[model samples]
Target: MNTLMVMGYGNSIAMSQILVVVVEILLLVKIGEPLECKRKEIVTNTPVISSNCYRECEYPSKPTVCEYEFNVVLHQTMSAHCGDCPFKKEDCNLEKCVPVDGSSRPLIAVNGSLPGPSIVVCEGDTIRVKVTNNLQSGAGVTMHWHGIHQTNTNWMDGVPRATQCAVARGSSFVYEFIAEPAGTHWWHSHAGYQRASGAFGPLIVRKSRKTEFNSNTYDFDLPEHTMTLTDWADMTSLDIALKVNIPALNPRSQTVTILMNGKGERIEFFDETGQIFKTPRQMFEVEAGKKYKIRLIGAFIAACMTSFHIEKHSMTIISTEGGEIIPYETDYLTIAQGERYDFVLHANAVPSAYCIYASGYGNSSCPSNATFILKYKSSPLNNPTCASYAVVPASQDRDQYMGNRSKGMFSAIDFVSSDPGDQELYRVDLRHYITLRSYAIYKHPKDPGYLNGFLAVDNVIYTPPLLPFVTNEPDDSDICQSTLNKTFYYTCGMKQCVCTNILKIKLGKVVEIVFLNTDEDIIQHPMHMHGGSFRLLGLGSFHTKKMTLDNVIQLDKEGGLLRNSPVKAALKDTVMVPSNGYAILRMKAENPGYWFFHCHTMNHGERGMVIVLQFGEPSEMPKPPLDFPRCEGWEPK
Candidate 1:
């Protein structure tokens, strides 16, 4: 990586060089340009780490640009059962096979690696990623920077139909943006159900850990401590989504396993002499008595609420959604789709192997669990006796999987933001009440017979428009409603009404959105925003069974709403709205452009649980580049 060098800091430089620097500074000011980090390339094995990359967020004088070239390819798994290979092994040759767990299933890999590759850079550095689509299946793709706030570069938000069109098959798209508000983040496929097939990776914008608010909580923040958790199924994501959409399918969609760091399946290895070698599972080796910062990513495509914990160990969560929070100690974490958390794990337990477990809600079809080994440097290489991938006993099951398990489980309201400036979030200027429900899509618009059921936000199903939201001049027919209200807008109940649902907000308004999940089925929806994160002010269950949108508004006005201190409210880009409950989120409408606000579940989002959160007028937003590609639905005469 390129580092900006200066001859002197105070008086160590020659007079002629100092004069040249002064002249350059004056020239830069005259042109109204700010200094940028020079672009550099580094090759590495792990995602988000390079030996030549900047070590501290405060170093290099000026930011250094990070560049990555990714080729999205369709690949297949290599080994199964006892032949599964461990992650990042030197002898894990991929010349003929790609080992992703023990299942020889098809996957959409990036450069032939599951979980893609990592992108790491210091805050304020420019990130330029050139992605070439080589799926060979004639499928288009788009990559969404999960927690990156695309400030001025709204076109790079990567939401197909909202920010820009999908990079078509065999085509390429270069995404350029400046990384800001550094924290743990991730990236995944934004087109179709490709993320379920492993088109995702870690995206970390580093800041000096020593300068962070809770930096003192952890002793070491190493690059190898990143853990990405994903729900996996035997079938491809497209096929799973198809089964989910069909009501007659016995179990809709199935999540058979959960993968950590792209490694699942507790399989054993053996030598040619028939002697047992070692078990292949994602292992995090640590030293006893040391505190390590572990970045956890919830990259699951399914809607199951997965709980993560290391046996006989506790975690102190320091940050989430790229925003630091006051350290909150918890036994385990219930993570939702598209969420990121950084916690400090103290390795003070006995120097032996322990089970790093992940358990989903214990539903027969959609629920499953997986385990990895957390081994100490002095521990043996064998698997832990306590590391059982089988069903956990009720006494050992910490995730009490009852309906809306909010009584004992830690919720968003439990976290407190460390930033003192977040007090402005509580001063809401506008309030919006959105109710989650399901509507039927009929075979014919006028026919009573329905083909399938689709989820919706605020009673309106989102249909991608023929034109992108940023470039299109949408009229009455394109949008579901011109104006929304504090309560319900238009009710499409069981009728088929799908349109572009865009909610406009005035620039700089502090908005409060109350999301109510009134669906009869017990399910959690992780609601995520594209442009920026928000303050998760409150979360609570409804007290009355007959509560409606108007009732919720009146309850809030009557001081019946659940709210924490505004100065210490939790900041998150995605908040899981509990089943048959509610979540209150507050944020300042600072980012100017069209942004996507949607349910992060893959199938739900694919079937229209999305809306556009438009800030400022269309004329005030940034425009796409002159040569930017444009596309629309196919038209035939």
Candidate 2:
């Protein structure tokens, strides 16, 4: 990347050389989103509106200063419009950053966007992103193109230990891959709590060619209609980890705010002089009666399951994790971390203001602070007359969505016939059953002190890291046989282990995995798998009266006959393993790579719940980037 940039910028070249340089420059500028390590906005001891704010401000950037009331409409007036693009190679520059959070605390940022820059690319375009780690000391940074299913490029999977090592601080590496299976997706840090700092963004893949899912779907498919709903902890993930490093600090229970496209009321700026500074809110405007393709990317860090709804509007589900699904209508939807849903909203209500909301789903009480406004140009901005909607429990909503009858719908099973969107469907070649049992491995086996709650739980536990997990190295061992010999490593870490158990699958084989969550207390584990989109075969309580691995596998073996199993499953890249329950996911192991499968809830992943899916002969896989960064010892020490 440096060579290309230097060569492109050099002078003293002939006319032909100059033309080549100009073409290269345009290509680089077209592909890469140049991110600055520092904010374009100037800073001061006192909170001040950035001088460049008016460049996007609706009122003026000139002598006449407009009051803050004009701020609400600025986002609409200033959003960058991505009109069109020819499918071609592209470049992106992502700088690791430490910026202030909504509450004005130091946080991580990428290219300055609180939630990072939303990447727009057409299906089939190959992209190369140069990521520079500019973060403060202690932590390294690496960005995972979540749900991109990098095909044969496993080295770019972005798991520090599983694929390539973390791109160390001050160093830069180029992440190049093909963007396939067009739909709503995202990118985030694969290391530490850095993701919580603002290192997250949407990865939207447009269809390769216009078809039903594209042209005939809705009236509007503008970039502005999409949003990345993110959760921000009042404290950084690193800070929380530090607190947990002490004897016994309770894990962060939830995020302080749920930001829509990285803006919310909870995110406020204040002057050093103690006066409150107004923060902009994300507002979506619509004509009174038109259908809009509203892509919702669930980019979360702390929260697991989130319930999203737009008051008085019905959202029809179109796709999940980048695969088109039969449109299903619902008032509210519950999604887990690393999940993406592209739905269509019918703005049929009267011209007025309505709130688009999303909140962490756990206890019946909902933290409804993360909200955005939906209004029409004809509606009154002040004293919006829309009434508040009641907060509903996710379990109730989850059951409703799961129990939804697939009769006469374009569900996954119904993909038997030819559909352009149904490009990648794997036959069930080899089925494997796995269960994730989350345990709070405390520093002490038996507690010597008493506390109000389970605050003594140390680091969230995971299986130990498979030492020396080199990116190019492939595990050709028989994983199934090793499991029987008790040679598979799972409990190596007992507490805070990074050991990864690699599940090897033959290329072109269809695989089904059943994940059962056994934590009695923490039931919702947002499981996200890389490299492939799996079908949500089924989700229910344990097959037997008790939750056992044997019973779960036995039940999964009979999935074809189980009454609860869907005849046609829905394709999803992420799903919340129900509390005390299990979910069966099926996908084809056609993409050869070392892909990590883990709980999207970062806490559980940090502990040891992660494992790798190794497919095909590694010799057939692409080599690691020539400039791929390496940790001190990627192989086991």
Candidate 3:
């Protein structure tokens, strides 16, 4: 068998492959015989240490008192199968799966549940989070608090290997920081492909008292219901990675059917048999003439641009990504993966149920899904049935209703722009090109590329690179060593080529990203970033000048450019880049820590369309404790 080893600095070098094999042998001897002996062998040979030693042992101690105090925790658990399964009964056994912590289970989870937990707080509040690792085996775990501004607290930003070592099995760590510039955000696991398993939750920060009142509102009521949409894959995260990146194991295409918190099996509604079965897909109800804000979070792995319509009533977008925006009325609003949109709908027409549907953007062939009825009561209007009503498309024209006088009325308060004097634009310190490649089941000469017809970035098919930045945290020596081997190379010279460039941004800097889609693949990619949102500056094919500002602009379609001509304005987080096209985006690096930038499409991210953004100065960042037990033999040379 192939052996994997880790060599320590000098004294007491222990090989990981040998240790694992020895432990496995011991386990085999005690299996079905003596339970105590098996337990002893496992504990003595394969000990589980407090992986959080670095976090707990850090020096200079955390501040005794801070601006705010928040408490949160992270726990690990097992799931039998993927949450997005139509058959719901196919639980991927946690016991037989590999990868130690049972993380290889078809649906192992962080915090013991799907959609994790909701973290709600006001702006400026100091928060403290305590994460507890509870899986059977050691599993690397990290958390990126989507858009919160915790400058210089990069180490505390949970990212396995990059920010610090993985939280050891049955260990805990405290993440403390202050929340700034409130907005709708999320948190997810940074470990290898774990986020796909279901390790994410909502991070909503309420607006400050001043900002809340200034927007001309009285009582601010939360949504009657909050819906998080996500796509589930049936295979284990590791298996998915192997199938996508490995050159000899080509797999079939996967599809998702269940929609959480929508008209799906998750909801328990009464059926004709008087038994509670899964609720059927339906429309949502809202009161006519009354204002209601719907918080839509696209937790799916793909990019989705949702459209809402209620016959004649128009919709107003009040907030996005948790930040307040100038209230503007429109027919439809687009949201992408890891993106959130909070819009207020004024139920002015006849009281009835409105159809709220989310359509998949890009080259998605998946059919759109619908939600339950939005009942508009408190009026003498009759409820319209589905047969008599027709669903209207979200209006794109902003000038039709408000007229030319309100053209730039709310432009000033729309989005936060960096001040020229305080603008800190840093040069692109680290540039890494990314690509996507597929591998077929066996090494066949006639196979188009790695996987049947898969392409590659540069010369090699893409594989997720080890996140060295977060992994080699605290220790300058190890960090420097990893950085020295930064430039990556792979082998993919057979078929098409599709690569992406990743830039490391400094905290508190304005970054301009230019994307050149070299027409390697025919499908478009919806590129998304965490933390701050970017404005679409320009977009066009390789032949012409860039087009106008659009959140989602289709790349070189067979029929001219697919532009949202009506809503030519800045968007919150998601944007689609056409195939073989070019696009540019401008954003501010307000939040510190390691953030993820990746393609919204699940298949693409799995095939290496993802990168990391390490914000903030290295000097100001905190270091892990000195007493932290190093990985068995992972010391610097």
Candidate closest to the true structure, highest TM-score? 1
Q: On residues 25-87, what C-alpha lDDT tens digit does candidate 1 reach at each position?
A: 788768734122222244553233222354667743356666677789888875442133443
lDDT head-to-head 2 vs 3, winner: 2
**Model 3: what TM-score?**
0.61
Q: Against the true structure, candidate 3 has what lDDT? A: 0.47
| Residue 215, model 3: Cα distance from true site in angstroms | 3.1
The better-scoring model by lDDT among 1 and 2 is 1
Model 3: weakest 10-residue lDDT segment is 49-58
Reference-based lDDT, residue 52, model 3: 17
Candidate 3 lDDT over 481-553, as tens digits, reads 1123333332233343333323446665666565555534545556766545565544544423433212123
TM-score attained by model 1: 0.84
Model number with the top lDDT: 1
Question: Where is model 1 poorest over a 10-residue stretch in terms of lDDT?
Answer: 398-407
- lDDT for predicted candidate 1 compared with the true structure: 0.75
In order, the Cα lDDT scores of the candidates are 0.75, 0.58, 0.47
Candidate closer to the true structure by lDDT (higher is better), 1 or 3: 1
Evaluation by TM-score, superior candidate among 1 and 2: 1
Off by over 4 Å in 2: 1-102, 242-255, 267-278, 363-366, 382-390, 393-427, 443-498, 519-521, 542-545, 554-567, 625-637
